[model samples]
Target: MRPPSRSSLILFAAVLLAGCASTSSTQTTPGSVPMTQDSTPLVGTDWRLVSAPGTRAGATLSGAGAATLRFEADRFSMRGPCNRHTGAWSRSGDQLRFGGEGGAVAGTKMLCPPEIMARETALLAAMQQPLTMEFEGPFLRLVAGDGSAWRFDSRDLPPAEGRERIVQVAGQRVPCTGAAPMLCLQIRTQPGAAWQAHYGEIEGFDWQVGVEYVIRVREYTVQDPPADGSSLRWVLEEVLERSP
Candidate 1:
């Protein structure tokens, strides 16, 4: 081991660095590296927009009905504060990809209040990128590539049993456009009372156009309704009266 030349010293330093790198790699902690796995059951889960780690603050979360994100089989839908958006979705390990390849999200263009539109714009942008999903109980968090996130809360379980009620249904369908273009049946609690357009559907009930009916029905809030559907469903219990 005579005095080492400059060339030898440089070579020795390089070998030392290479050995240290090998050792460091072998000694790395499992938690220090990201782990990927199949995410929780996202299908049929409807997440209501709420405050999250790095999402917009205050009014955005509190305004309107906020927004909702629901996942399906290879697809996802979002109801923004203003518009309705939908896109193709697929998950790999812990990541969620929106659209298809490089496609953009599609949505309705209905204009809304300025504050609502602002929130909708941000929500739509967030959904168009790569996201890492995490869940904690009833909450879901979607972290974007830039570290920002959108958090949604949910309790999609079905509700308790319903109560039976007696009601009258008109013989004809009236046009109702509350949520979208559709026809609604006129219903009332009393025969002499005013008729209110029933925006929600009545299950298990069939009506002939010229026949009026009085029926006993079971009404309850749906436990796991569709993302854009009404939570209430009325099922016909008994036919008390039917007159043509």
Candidate 2:
């Protein structure tokens, strides 16, 4: 047997440490670690956000500015771009009922970029819709139908036109702008109508840039219908921004 020496003892300790580190690294690798694929769908499983729309927002999970949703069975907790919110939800097929019990989570007062803030508000409002969930691995994507088949970005929004359509509010031929995405009607109170409602949006698909935009409006009937043929006008609203 080799006689014990201070140098030898130090060498033995180093070798043992090296072995332990190698084993730990190997176990952490994707394949070497034993992983049992969960056959069950993710609806009932508690899932935290693993990826996000942009890094400008910072890492997902564990931050107020971070957008996260921890979903487990029928309950969920969310952290919006500005506030922390959580609520209970129920799912049937693609339809989702998102409000049962939840409140804002208290956290630090950190402000995000304007665009990020806008997107976060829109996303939170959208959660109110009955949702359809698509499961891919550990991710659950929820989608809502706001009657928009396409999406657009802020840059994509066309310049507002000066031309206007002559429509009677109280009863007047007011100048107005009418376009596919934008609709504006100027009212002249003197002529009985003097208010203009301008609405516009653009839509397209550019995944590399991450843009989803839509604008819509819903119309209803008053006790008296306008001279115009239509009694109701519906509009949807959405805006997408390029990831910077």
**Residue-wise lDDT of candidate 2 within 13-104, one digit each (tens)?**
21110100111111121112112342334443334443334333322222323355555644565555545555555544344455533322
> What is the lDDT, from 0 to 100, of the residue 122 in candidate 2?
69
What's the true lDDT of residue 241 in model 1? Answer: 50
Note the Cα lDDT for every prediction shown. Answer: 0.60, 0.35
lDDT of 2 at 211: 21
The residue ranges of model 1 lying beyond 4 angstroms of the native Cα positions read: 1-40, 52-65, 101-104, 156-244
C-alpha lDDT (0 to 100) for residue 105 of candidate 1: 56
lDDT of 2: 0.35
User: How does each model score on TM-score?
Assistant: 0.44, 0.34
Model 1 residue 186 lDDT score = 85
